[model samples]
Target: EDQVTQSPEALRLQEGESSSLNCSYTVSGLRGLFWYRQDPGKGPEFLFTLYSAGEEKEKERLKATLTKKESFLHITAPKPEDSATYLCAVQGVTGFQKLVFGTGTRLLVSP
Candidate 1:
């Protein structure tokens, strides 16, 4: 079975503080790793997709990196507006449309 585990279930940061969130996974064969952001009462918003190891993507204060075993979401100089639940998911070669997801890391940024 494919599985994902995210660390530190929750994180607290001061405004402008930087940090990285971890997503570890085990799959039969990795097709893609996905990153998402979700605000309270809203659906998750797609952030990045990594297809191979050493691949990276970035937008504003957030950067996503993928490796063979895990992925990381780096937040640089985060602001209160950047706080959200960050989710990680993966699609395995066996299941083209099936995604296994971690519970997510809840990030709270205080000014």
Candidate 2:
């Protein structure tokens, strides 16, 4: 079974504070690790896509990296707008085309 799970279900950070969130997974063959930011009552916004281990991508104050067993989302100097549920998903082998997802890490950035 391919699955993704995130830790620290929720996190609080003051503006300008930095932190890292983890997303662990179990799968037969890892295709990709995707990070998305979802605001309350809305759909997820694509963040980053990690294709292999040691590969990293970044935009604005957010950085994402992938490993064999896990991925990390790092926020630097977060702002209130960055306060959103960060979702991690994994694309791997299944019966058909279905993505395994992590519950998500809720990040709260206070101004």
Candidate 3:
């Protein structure tokens, strides 16, 4: 059963605080680990593509790292405007890009 589950469900952070969010995945074969940031009214925006354990990517205050069975999204010095839904999806063995997404972790960054 290919699936993804995010922890905490929601998180609250004060501006300038750093925190890490978790995403666990279970699948037959992991093709790629994807991290996306979704705003209130728009589709997810791709943040990172982690291919293997120890792989990581970063942009501004967001950093994403992947392992065999899990991924972590770390936010540094987050701001109120950074509040958004963080979604994690994993690509399966199938050739198609049918990424199974976790429910998402809603983050509310307050100033």
Candidate 4:
């Protein structure tokens, strides 16, 4: 079976706080791992794409790293503006790319 799981469904952080969010997944054939940020009432915005283990990508206060079975999103000195729901998805190459998304991690950063 193929599934994606994200921990701590929700998180609250004060401005300047830092934390890491986890995404655990199991797929028969992983073509890629994707990270996205979704603001309330809006569609997801692409963040990163991990095509293999040991791959990593970063932008501003966020860093995403992927391993064989898991991925991590690390936030450094987060700000209130950084608050959003982080989504993790896996794509399998089964004739085509099909994305399976995790429930997502809602992060609230208060000033």
Q: Best by TM-score, which number?
A: 1
Alpha-carbon lDDT, every model: 0.95, 0.90, 0.93, 0.94
78: Cα error in model 1, Å? 0.1
**lDDT tens digits, residue span 1-111, model 2:** 888889889999999999999999988887788999999899989889888999999999999998899999989999999999999999885546567889999999999
TM-score of 1: 0.98
lDDT value for candidate 1? 0.95
TM-score between model 4 and native: 0.96
Model 2: which ten-residue window has the lowest total lDDT? 91-100
Q: Write the per-residue lDDT of candidate 4 for residues 7-88, one digit (tens) a residue.
A: 9899999999999999999998999999999998999999999999999999999999999999999999999999999999
Worst 10 residues of 3 by lDDT: 91-100
Per-prediction CA RMSD (Å): 0.6, 1.1, 0.9, 0.9
Question: Per-prediction TM-score, please?
Answer: 0.98, 0.95, 0.96, 0.96
Clashing pairs in 2: none
In candidate 4, list every pair of residues with a backbone clash: none
- Model 1 residue runs over 4 Å out of place are none
* Of candidates 3 and 1, the better by lDDT: 1
Residue 54 lDDT (model 2): 100
Ranking by TM-score: 1, 4, 3, 2
User: In candidate 1, what are the lDDT values of residues 17-86, reduced to their tens digit?
Assistant: 9999999999999999999899999999999999999999999999999999999999999999988999
